[model samples]
Target: MAIRMHAALRRCTWLLALGWLTSLPATAALPEDPFRSPMWEYNLARYLGADAAVRHSDTVVIKTPPFAEDATQVPLTVDLSAFPHEIKEVITWVDLNPVPHLFTLRPEAAEIRTVALNFRIQQASTVRAAVRDEQGGWHVGSVHVEAAGGGCTAPSATASNPDWADSFGQVRGALFSPVGGVTGTRLKVQVMHPMDSGMVGNIPRFNIETLELRQTANQQRLASMALSESASENPLFVFDLEHDAQQSGILLLLRDNGGNLIESRMGI
Candidate 1:
């Protein structure tokens, strides 16, 4: 009689556990890729990790020319103004380039609304921008660009110039009041570099590895970025910073893999 009573208790516990599991909510499925490129799955797992919680979001906007007039200097813009959550980080990459990784931007003391840069593409490819929110979810935006071949393997225009080294590491920047009645400051900066991808014969990979924007008065870093070889020869970067009177004066600092440092200042 005691043995029979123990078996009945065990059966009751098993049924209760099953019921609890069935009552739990099911996880939502990830959204399908709009572009549906073959490289989508591979690049997603490779760059964002296989276990990342990623979903396609309309709030993360990626803008680029449908047909690239200049493959080596294609312009790309990522706008995050419509994101409902606080952004933690932003990453951009080209799907089919030899060196696919483009840049990673982390906002420190600044609220980055929009970022724009020029990059090279080896061929027609899909470009992606993934924004990570405070809750550790990745919101992705993608756009397809058509281009001719040889953007990566071609020799840089700066490298062919006889006086390329004369203006190396030079920086020019300007600050403007917010445009379109927006409540922020607009910063445009250009850095002179060969940005060699080493794909061409005898050209070693030489490009800016790190860049930082800081407050000129206290040297407090507002934002930082890590760049890769896929960037254009002389990169033009545009940033939209949230309005802050205390952040009137800005400093730009850039360092390359060749141990070269460039610094410049711009005042609002």
Candidate 2:
């Protein structure tokens, strides 16, 4: 019995070693590039999870500068008036932003279409804007924003928050405001989260794991940005009015990787 137990332990050890070997990066760089190769698989529709039937439609327009002088506060705009009842929602993403999809703003009605926002970029990167039409179709737009510093790995964690450390990956967030009326009426929704690259480290553990936003918050979600580390710090967002936002109902909600929710409410 003693010999059998020893053999079992040895076999387990070998398996663990092999698993680690497979996971280890080929190069021993301080911080490795998350992208393995150039011909990597990448499809925005599949990545953004629009739908199997959803085709790329050129129905939406994104407004932003061709280049940015400051990456921290790159301005962006999207007009919904061009879209009729077909616009489901409008979404934006800063490829280099620490948390791309800086925020997802959901409109209450198809009538309300224009939106303007500011996002921070960590470095020079491409920015994408997508629109979800009324029939559940998706339209996309792309731009490039340049910046000097990246917001990821920023020493901006709040010590009071519990999940601040693991917020490296994408986080799920929302902002809801009653447009013209309350409950079931006109409303706008937004999401806040980090699109972690999994290249960063946990200061203490020095370990890396798959960090991403869960589907629970994403499926019910109207739109999202597959962001990188180039996004800004404490992303701020806004959208046009559709429904009547009542007092105490206006708010921006966010949850870190551990599912702790933090909300900021506007008194209206």
Candidate 3:
């Protein structure tokens, strides 16, 4: 079994390297496919460091209006109905955001067939909401965020990031306010972060780290492995859950490459 595992690991590594070649367009000047499908990029393997694949779906709707005036506060929403069963996680990503992964939520108490939340858009580009079902299949929906900026590179509200050392959630001893009636509390948990991609060098030579949401009460995780660059800056994760009067829950998040951990408890 060890030998087979090693061989499989080597094969995966080889294929991952080839993914870069496959992503390049036939032309050097126009390397980026204007209509490139996010599902085809081997992102799960290349970025998230996992071998995740997605299945496209029209049922999934990535809600972003054609125009947004404020780059700092833009509303983004996602809705998928009668979605496939293979789905285990749902995520909304900005193709142009410095990091892309804005926020992702797992079905804490429900499958979360729909979501709605306000997000900061950094620029105009194709955004996507990708879902990984229980069966290990992926479903995705993309949208366009008009010209906006200031989100991807914003500094932390306070000085240095708290010494939570990867801890995530509300401020110390903060109470959780559960929302939603129809679908129970439509909870939207967010991690405070810049989600800085090392590629970003505003002045030059300075690099920002990647941020991500890592875990939840739900058995299935969002998009793929714990969150990563697939999200946007200061990721605001919107999701739904069943109202179990007898249940208490917490949202576990990892920051900067999914290493640090934090917990946000749900309020009654």
Candidate 4:
């Protein structure tokens, strides 16, 4: 009986070793454990599939504040301009949030390779950005954000304000000169909406469903993004305007899930 027990233990050890080996990354240079959650394996298997291979990439930059003063409105930026060729789509999420998937952006124009948005973080979480290339390979970027917690379940700030709906869908925008030789116009835009995630209070999910940025002079579409309930109230976006935004200005058009439309322009 003792010999049988010893053999069972050895079999278990070999299975564990096999599991770890199969999980080894396709690229050894890139670490695979960016999620850092105890359920990282489970989450990746569920979200990315067991057969998916993700490569860590410096070209796909994920930026977030080290500490979030307001967890409900934590800022996030994903830039893949460094590898600006044949990007299929970009997916972003907060690993620890109740609603993990924040947004998905598929740029109609290849020149628009960056996205900036605000999202909620339930607690300390690793924010992730994954870009799918033309070949279907995914390049990933991640950042750790520290928060005080309750961002997801907290009451909506817009619901409490009482004046949010009056300006719902109104977009205010501005352009700023390049800072520290960034070589692009800093385009900042804010849209008025509650962006209620439905996790807080009795609020049902009412948020901006889609938004597009266009050059006002030529009406050329620059970038478009889809936002979900994971977005914070009064969603704010700041992005790099490459060429025409400074000269021709830009227009922001957005629509909420409730079928409300908002359009505004800057530098017209």
Candidate 5:
């Protein structure tokens, strides 16, 4: 009698799952077809609450190439110039990655309207940038990036190095005059750390926790961004700096999940 009851429950569960799957539209957003339908409903509802609304905006642009040559270091740029003053925060993530949440940036000033970032894509996924306005509305911009294979579950290249610990928090940065329609002085920064999410084999979760960019002249903070374990190992970033700022340099301060703080300066 117990065996028969268990079998009956299993059959009912299977029927329910089948019904749910069949109820979805043919163009439904699934793991196989992420671009056809935006697969961000779960993430958006979870992070921004179920009542939050997300709409497409021309002002919020996510720029990336159609195909990424390197799945582990695809270059992306987010532009928030249209609603600069109204933007309260920006959150970026990949739709299909094992751990999707990438980072969140809260601009301390209106000058921080654009940012260039490097992150990993597990597969062909929809990368989204959601900007929260001062009035509490979320504006979304997304782009599709294709990769030949996976990135998130792959073993870290830098993590296996014997010398990784010696240079864990080492930072390198430089500033260059804007070219190719990029405004102001472009600040490029690279930090050494394996942003492991623990999804890959025996690796445990380790990532950069916080990043602060400040002007050296007045010690005034320009922006603060928070990163999650979903970020690529050895994260890289670029930001546009106001051309007429008083400083000839900018300071970089970062803290990792292990609570190690490292600071450096980049001359403009």
Candidate 6:
């Protein structure tokens, strides 16, 4: 009887353990690709790393034209206003472009709700914006754009102009009142550069490598971004910053791969 009771007790303990395991929530499987691109897996591993925890998220919205009229100047807007979690970093890329990586933005002392810029597309490609949350999970948003091709290889308009060097590294920026119900300042900045992709004949790749926005008073960095050759020439960047005071003043600093630095002040 003692042996039988001991055996019964062991069986009951095993059953309890199994029940507890079954009651716990199941781990979520990765979602299916919405764009169905062949390079999805490869690009994901290449840019976001092989072991990144990724999922398709509606909160991370990528707004761009379905058909790109000019592949060299296709506008892209990444909106993270609806994302519930705190963002650590944002990376944008074109899957089929010769230089696939576009830009990586790390919000240091600012709240970046939206980021807009123009980029070059080699062909009809899938564009992706991957936002990394505080928990290290990457939420991805993707869109497809149809193009006629040759955007990356084509010579920039700035390259053909003889006087381009005269205005090179010039920065023009303005701070406007917030629009579209957003409660922050809208900063639009245009930088003059050839932004050569080196794909064009005899034009070596020259582009802005790093950009920083800071408080003019204390030089406190608000945000910083790293750009690549995939960006368009004379890049126009739009950032929605949480800082709205015109008196606080904002400083723009840009650096190129050739060791050129441009600095300007706005909202003074």
| RMSD versus native structure for model 5 | 9.0
TM-score for predicted model 2 compared with the true structure? 0.49
Task: Please provide, for model 2 over 84-104, each residue's C-alpha lDDT reduced to its tens digit, 9 standing for 90 to 100.
Answer: 455555556665444555445
Backbone clashes in candidate 2 total 35
Against the reference, the lDDT scores of all candidates come to 0.89, 0.47, 0.53, 0.77, 0.79, 0.90
Identify the runs in model 5 with alpha carbons over 4 angstroms from their true place: 1-38, 82-85, 177-184
Order of candidate numbers by TM-score, starting with the best: 1, 6, 5, 4, 3, 2
Local accuracy of candidate 5 as per-residue lDDT tens digits, 161-235: 988899888888787776686556677888988888777877887888899988887777878899876677888
Candidate 5 lDDT (Cα, 0 to 1): 0.79
- What candidate 6 gets wrong by more than 4 Å, as runs, is 1-30, 179-182, 244-246
TM-score of every candidate relative to the true structure: 0.87, 0.49, 0.54, 0.77, 0.78, 0.87
Best by lDDT: 6
Candidate 1 lDDT, tens digit per residue, 193-219? 999998999889999999998988888
Per residue, candidate 4 scores C-alpha lDDT tens digits across 1-268 of 9999999999999999999999987642334585567655555555555766677788989888899999888888887679755777777878888878887776654255567998888899888887878777777787888899888888887788767668767777797776687766667888878888888656788888888877888788877777877798888887764654466777788888889888888775
Candidate 5, residue 30: how far the Cα is off, in Å: 19
Off by over 4 Å in 4: 1-31, 38-51, 177-184, 243-246
- Over 219-241, each residue of candidate 3 has an lDDT whose tens digit, in order, gives 23322224543334455655544
Candidates sorted on lDDT, descending: 6, 1, 5, 4, 3, 2
Clashing pairs in model 4? none
